[model samples]
Target: MTPIQALYYFVEARPTRTGPPNVGIGAILLIVAAAVFIAWVAWLWIAARPSSGGEETALNLQPYLSDDELETTKLNRVLRAAM
Candidate 1:
């Protein structure tokens, strides 16, 4: 009569089937989905590959500006404005 007992009974009870279980379409769909996913990943990997003839650009970093100094300067400006 309790909720747990009812749930347990529901899970334990099996319905009588007149025919065989149909899983052929489901299996085929699963295989197709897996193949599509793999193909997509392979395509992305191939498309994103860097060209052999392209030259790599050098990164330019400012030597005069330090991150810590920049942060301190911003904090000082905010504090001065607040005062």
Candidate 2:
């Protein structure tokens, strides 16, 4: 017999057990939960990483402005936006 057919027959030849079938259900749920947890962690890790592009670096202006100047700039921006 071919390996595939032999393996199939081996799987089909297992004796049936008379008991509550909760083990299979619990195993399936555990696998699903682990998959979901892994996906969530992967998403969080990806999102927490800084982008490789220059956009974020270009937007940083803290080094060029004093506190007072920053506050004034903010006020001016708000006033301009209000108009």
The prediction achieving the highest lDDT against the true structure is: 2
Q: What would the per-residue lDDT of candidate 1 be over residues 4-67, giving only the tens digit for each residue?
A: 9999899889687799677678898999999999999999999999889776565564365688
Residues 1-51 of candidate 2: C-alpha lDDT, one tens digit per residue: 999999999999999879978668889999999999999999999999998
lDDT, each prediction: 0.86, 0.89
TM-score of 2: 0.40
Note the clash tally of each candidate: 0, 0
User: Once superposed on the true structure, which residue ranges of model 2 sit more than 4 Å away at CA?
Assistant: 1-23, 56-83
